[model samples]
Target: MFIIIPQTPQNYALRIKQHAERTANLDIRSGVNYRGLAGFLNRPFAEDHRDATVDVTNPAEPPLVCVKSLVEGGRQTARSYHAVSDCATFEQDPPSLVNKAAHLVWLQGYPAPEWINAIGAQYRVDPEFFRRHLIFLQSKDNHDFAAMPSSAQRMLTLRLTTICHTQFALRQTAIEAARNEATNAVRQHQQRLRTGDSVVRKYSVFDNTIFTIDQELAIYVERKKQHNGWIAIVCSDLGKDLTQGPGGLSSPWLGEEPASPPACEPVIMHVPKLALKHPHQHRFVNVTSNGSPLMYQNASLLADTIDLQSGGDDIYLDVREALHDVFTLIAAAESQFLTMVQGLVDREIQLQSSGKQTEWTLSNLRYFKSSIDDHIVNLENTLDFLRHPDVPKWAPHTRSPRALSREGTPAGQAQHSRYRSPQGEAFAEYSRLSSLGDDYTRLLQRATKLSNRCVENTTILMNMAMLEESKKAIVQADGLTRLTLLAFFFLPLSLTTSFFGMNFRELGTGSMHMWVFFVVAVPFLLFSTLLCFWGAVLPNFRGRMQWAWKMFTSGAR
Candidate 1:
């Protein structure tokens, strides 16, 4: 149902320019002509698209695109898989769904500019709505995905899945590795200090280690903002086929008259897959299920749920259920994030409790502080999204009251009738979303508290590091003072010896007695010793001297 196809970069600016020129007269507003439009389109995502001279030598790898189809025949609903190797073909002459059908067509990938217009035309969407959709895609704003924008006539579903476990695991590994390296570096530095090596060399090692870890964390946070984003569209007229009453679509395949394909296309969805740029980048793997990528598996599961629950008969119920499923994925992502933050909190606690906080450099504290701050900002954004009024109200019922009244009526007095009102289902879904929101709120609170704890721990680590530095400085000053005093005490003795060793005439003729040299050296050595003792007690003398200086200055004044 899902596969990857190579998509090299094309002249996107030229495409937009041509399209804008063709549609120039449609909008007569000042500065709303082809040039402006082209400029606007060029600004988003790939700004290099604006430059005609830019080379496309390093084209990106292929990205995964999913195309799924569910069609109705006489007595059964048949499912099929499709792959669009040529996006142009998929856009201009897309595969059709049965007109008299209760089927679902899901296409997931990024659409070319022309493809966006084609989707608008196929869905009978308002040109204005599709233009906004086009701009939405062009903007590539992740926050909009979180906001879940929609229009009454079109069901625009945009979702940003959590960071894939592969990527998350890689980042976690990086975090742990950095922590271990810093820990080891700290130990080595302490050993060097004990062995009397130059402190400056060990300082460099610590600085480099911390800087590397900080850079890694910075990258992690930056990439965190850009998780796998997805957009899905459900046509407003999807329920029209169901309006034709029970037995599904009247298809040529059923009567066996050469079984021609249906005239209408299936509902297409788009998912722009990112190319892997590094060894540790996202890779397709089993996420919460086996044998398929996470989003694809999720899509399949969603299709299965629709097939089972509403039997693909009620579009409203289908959308409701789909949105609920999406929220479930979001909730799971949030829980995972919470767990990650908790791990960080625990690590900080471990570092502190194990007495390693004293060894932590300011750089180490900086990484944690940056990590905590980034997560808090991200969590606050997520929490705001969860608490947004629009979240619970998503996929609201758009049917007329009369239709609702008709659907609400019970199907006879049968005890086990499968007659569930759309209203009841909507209420149930709303309640589910609200409950999920509450859970997210609790998770956010926990994450916030954990982040705050990390902040506190960072502060403690900073203080401890400062204290350690102060202690080291004090010890160094004490050692220097001892060395200075020792040197000074022996200074006079050295001077006296040097003076007596000089080749003087009196000394050469043995006119000078050896006791004269001893007498002179002894008094000088004693005087130096007394001076060392006086300097040792110099602080006491300084306080008295300061008092005396104040009195003297006061008298002078």
Candidate 2:
């Protein structure tokens, strides 16, 4: 299974003879088994069976899983049986996307470097270049990989198991192809959403958001807009944390391996990550759009139920990270609403009046309130996705002193040799995210208060409008009253004058005396009516008439 080559040309005859004998015994004509080899390597996320019950609880051992291995032998194609009986896929690459295609397939399961080199030769770059140089540039600033555990190796097999079991080789350009499709769709949609006259980097607000990240710098952001031409920009920031070694430059062994580059950081190597439970070593993989999350988990390697049930500080780091990422997103949404609120408040204050529906209205507040309720529920659901699982089967556990002692273990003593995960530095970062979630909840409350204040302002403005209408109504009523009184006072005198002028033989004769009475009486009545209204109604009528004149002249429309 191994060879030790000496760096010498000193024994050519003897070495040639030995090589010939070994080659004769072995079938040199046999081809390499790439498919079975790939399938065997598929189990990246394996359970070490560190838990004893997995094997014992099995009713019976499963039959050997076999796949045909097809390899190239010189000019001919050849085949072989690659049995997955107690396959050591997990044993091969463990955590890194090593066996699978990641930066460089430098791990155990990949075909020999010479084979990969042969393929690379067609593309004018050696497979050795990655093993030699490029990989060193990746994963520099992340302590995240360093702080994880062997159980985390489950991450690797997530995608591999799917790719192999579903029986498809990892596409050489899967990311590239999917990326072009997704980017084009998103870019087109963005173009549709943007107005041709839109400006950038200004104090404007929006109802939706698009986010982007500078991959190389690791500068992730939820941007307000999808800046034009940004799709063409490839963010090629490999992490700086790589090549600095797992312990970093501060390690005492700086004097070691001086020839080659510094040791690589412990990469959180995986093509996907989701979660579930399994026996032996079941693996899974997920692929997502750029800046989206993927899941990889091996469920069979978890702690006991007692520890997992303990809430609060005892959750897994992956769970914590998920929670943090979600809350951060929710907070971004709230921030958008808050920004709109700020602009509206400024406009209202300037106008000294509640703006109309098309400008700024109560509906904005109402929509904001409804959104808050919906999102809080969603936030709870997000947490539930992490919690609602057979988590005890894969996640690490940490029990408090009392819980540990319930099994009668002493304070400083160990408990059942179970996997007790520590609250490592990684967990601390996740905790910050959790705290940020709380902050967003508080921000939501503040927004609710502001919403209330806006409602109150609208109410006050409405009342003032009612008062102005009431004052106009009073003035119009006074004018109508004066006109009614004048008509009523003249009624009897006008009737008498009409009777005298009838000129009927039985009714009466026309008379100059009647005319004299009518003229005198009408004048007296008019004078009395005028005196009655003169002081009391004049001011109101003049003011109302002036208002009507102003309305007619100014063309209020």
Winner by TM-score: 1
- Give residue 287's error in model 1 in angstroms: 14
What digit string (tens of lDDT, one per residue) describes model 1 on residues 290-393? 22211112222232233323323333223333344444544554455456546645765786778764344334445545554554555565455444433222
User: In candidate 2, which residue ranges exceed 4 Å CA deviation?
Assistant: 1-318, 354-430, 490-497, 500-509, 515-557
Give all candidate RMSDs, comma-separated: 18.6, 26.2
> Could you give me the TM-score of model 2 versus the true structure?
0.31
Which lDDT value does model 2 have at 378? 40
* Clashing pairs counted in every model: 8, 22
